[model samples]
Target chain A: MGGGITLEHFLVLGLILFLLGAYCVLTRRNAIGILLGIELMLNAANINYLAFAFFGGARYDGQIFAIFVIMLAAAEAVIGLAVILAIYQNLRTIDVDATETLSG
Target chain B: MLNSLAAQAIFYVIAALTVGFAALVAFSRNIVYSAFALVGALMGVAGVYILLAADFVAMVQVLLYVGGIVVLTIFAVMLTQGIGDLAVSNRAVGPGAGLAVVALAGAVMLYATLRTPWHLATAVAVASTTYGIGNAFLGVYVLPFEIASLVLLAALVGAVTISRQDTPPPADGAAEKGRS
Candidate 1:
């Protein structure tokens, strides 16, 4: 309170978000759920990047990197959802647990 | 100062919105709920970007992540049938193990975050970053910028290719028999 908001505050917040995202990825059976988790994790990383950029000199590098991450995330979501739709077309279910053809 | 206090309050509110909705996204039983909760979590992150003075990134977050990705997720959730069964649709596996892993990772990350001696400098004065970002994208980051556009084009084409339904079999008895 005395120092107002510190870097640690943002760092801790990002950490919590990352952990929750990890939990989501680890526990969820649906592929889309896992994708949701991934989005959260990516955002958590972006938070850390912006936080550092803000506190470490306010350079544009971190912001640029965050934008790239967001772009890649958009790509990933499109590809991932398309794959899920493909799986659904063939198997009729989007359950991650059910799609184990590669497990063999 | 009163200004700092107000900033702190705003930060707290943004943090609460982010973490609370993230929790809902992680733990909600319905995939639809999780997808929708992600909207809140993402918006909260955009707020955090604003708080960090990244106006351009914040707007991009709203435009891309919230506007595009969340809607795409919701559409995916609806397209897949059997969404009404809340119990099995978004079932979680090994919650006990997941909790253990999260705790371990959280503890490690928290310890590292608290113990690290971060080199901090006085933050730059808040200003419009759109100009600086545009310049950087065209100048020092030009190569990567081009590469990103390539990636997006590839992804766009790949998504269409992958999701396109197989051409309906020719409306012929022989074609229908072969498809079956």
Candidate 2:
């Protein structure tokens, strides 16, 4: 409120988003839901990177890191979905609880 | 005064959109609904990037996330048949335990964030971050940049190979293809 916004605001927001992702990951039964949670967590980290970069006066570093993070997330999503598809093909279900062939 | 007020207002709006939709994404029972909610959450994150003056990153977020990842998620959801039906239980396991853990983790992060003495510089004129980032990737960070592209290539190949392994048997012919 003093001069508009602060790094703390961004950091707090990122934390909330990160926690939400964690919550989803913990609770969701679907593998794709877990993947979505992971994506959310990555984005939360991106927010922190940009906030620090902007406040620390090293703008490009944070932006570059965010770019890499985004690329990694995309790659992860592709591989994950493919794995999920394969799992469904093999087991005929995408439920993490039900697909326990390796549990023993 | 008015400008700062406007910025603060915008920040609040974006923050709400981000957190609210993210919660929806996390808790929604329908897989398709969850994917769609993720689109809103991701867009809010892009708005946050714009607020941080990372214009290039924001555009990339919109492009890669909104246009690509979200669409791909929805497509995957559509392709998988049982996901839409209630046969797939999307409910969270032990809701109390999960929320408790989230609360604890949120508390720890909030504490660390508030306690840390972050070195903040006076706000300066932010030239386009795109130029600097592009230059660094071409210069100092070139190796990492190339590696990221390689990762993408590998992922592309791997995805196709993995998903294509279960070709419909020729004996079952049309029936198996229709069933799949």
Candidate 3:
């Protein structure tokens, strides 16, 4: 069980995921794109949790935490999209540049 | 050496596809394409989880993110078709190099954290861990779980309310029971 795949492999994957997610969030201006970025970041953390759970030879606390993270991400997306719709209804756009009336 | 060779081959394939698709998602101008690329990246991660032997989590990843979230995003993209079509600023990706730098720094930090010393529990502890997770979810984390469900309920209500007023049911929405 502990012969081939190791914790290090999981950790590196999680790191790459984290970086990709951060780049997505920072660069995208569209509301949904931003939301996807956030989802990616959340999933990166979740991956880490699962990897550690299985490979760090720990109790399933990490897995439990990952499950919670997934649930929370779903809830967040729903709420975020709703908010985006509300904003779009009033302003008719999702560009962060255009919706900066209150950015002060 | 043979085991690592096999693993490396698989990892290289997944890593290339995952990073490439993820970059497309971040760089693509079209919102729908970005969503599609995100789905691709997510599916890749799920595959990695499978390779890591976390079968349950991998399935959940595919089901929740790819099936549920990606589908919902596509529906949203279809709904907002008119909005996304308008010409966006060509310079949306300004200072792309700076953002890349930040991402690189974050990547390094995360790698360092992962490499830092962490205690590893014994296999006996790992053996009952799955059951422990279940009991912990119910026993210790129940309150948060219940609260999260309520939040989801609220989101459902909010989604209905938002998508209702501006656009009435046009058969696309299919909210017609007796309205037609």
Candidate 4:
């Protein structure tokens, strides 16, 4: 007579999402694609936060962390995209592999 | 019991939607498709938040993540030329090594999650968490909240400066310099 959904279920989902985001980060050449991967990883972290809040305690601490994470993700995306645009202006390419002006 | 069963079903559906679209985001060759697929994946995450009784977080996820961040990402993708063209290879390089590493990491995480003895709390009544969250933000977490806003302001200024510095000199500036 137990509830079917367990904490493990949610944690496993977060794990899967995190791994997928890692894969995206490792494989994609597009700078924006890498940014997308980072976003995925952040969302996975958010999932873990809410899941823990739901099952670990009666506190709203986890939800607060999730909100903070969302805000940070927005800031990161804004800065990352701005950097990408600047790189494009300098190099005229968005391919992470090809943008090597900094290598010197 | 029946209600619990129905909740379990919804949970599985949302989990599937989240993971499936996440896979699409990882594998799609078209960057636009991947960006759009991220929308579905993030929406699924929001749905899971609702299932966890976090109504406020879910709404914020949809509004900020799906509405703002994803749209900004799509615009960035479009602004960077040659990314949208299918001729450009969006294919994953070093496939074998990447897959192996992902598998190894995923397996470790799954094992850890399933094996950990999590301190499970009794299912308490789901109260209005939005109020509690807001109160905490304005009360105990006020310092962190203010710091977050400050960080955001700094990031805004930094982004504007970074973008502005790279822009080619305006015609007026160039003419002024020539006249000088």
- CA deviation > 4 Å runs, candidate 4: A1-3, B1-3, B85-93, B165-180
- CA RMSD for every model? 3.3, 2.8, 4.6, 3.1
* lDDT digits (tens) for residues B1-180 of candidate 1: 213988999999999999999999999988898999999999999999999999999999999999999999999999998655354333445888888989999999999999999998865688889999999999999999999999999999999999987847666657575553
Candidate 3: stretches off by over 4 Å: A1-5, B1-8, B82-93, B100-104, B107-111, B122-133, B161-180
What's the CA RMSD of model 3 in angstroms?
4.6
Encode model 3's per-residue lDDT on B1-180: one tens digit a residue.
Answer: 214768868877886777777777766778777889988898888877666555666777889889888887776666554545334222455446647676678768766876688665543421334456667768988887788788778878877777555645566655664563
DockQ of model 3 vs. true complex: 0.42
Residues A6-67, candidate 2: write the lDDT tens digits: 89999999999999999888887788888889989999999999999988888888899999
Model 2: CA > 4 A from native = A1-3, B1-3, B85-93, B167-180
**B1-180, model 4: which lDDT tens digit per residue?**
114878889989999999999998987887888899999999999998888888999999999999999999999988888776343333545656778999998888888888888898877688778899999999999999999999999999999888765445677675655432
Residue B121 displacement in candidate 3 (angstroms): 4.0
TM-score of chain A of each: 0.95, 0.96, 0.91, 0.94
Q: TM-score, each model? A: 0.92, 0.93, 0.79, 0.92
lDDT (10s digit) by residue, model 3, range A1-104 = 33555566666666767676667676666778778778878877887887777656653567667777887787677777777777777778777667878978
Chain B TM-score, one value per candidate, order as shown: 0.88, 0.88, 0.70, 0.87
Error of 2 at B119 (Å): 0.8
- lDDT value, candidate 2, whole model: 0.87
Candidates in descending TM-score order: 2, 1, 4, 3
Residue B49's lDDT in candidate 3: 66
Could you arrange the candidates by DockQ from highest to lowest? 1, 2, 4, 3
For B1-180, candidate 2 gives per-residue lDDT tens digits of 213778889999999999999998887878888899999999999999999999999999999988998888888887776775343333445678888989998998899999999998777696777778889999989999999989999999999889885665788577667655
Model 2 collision count: 0
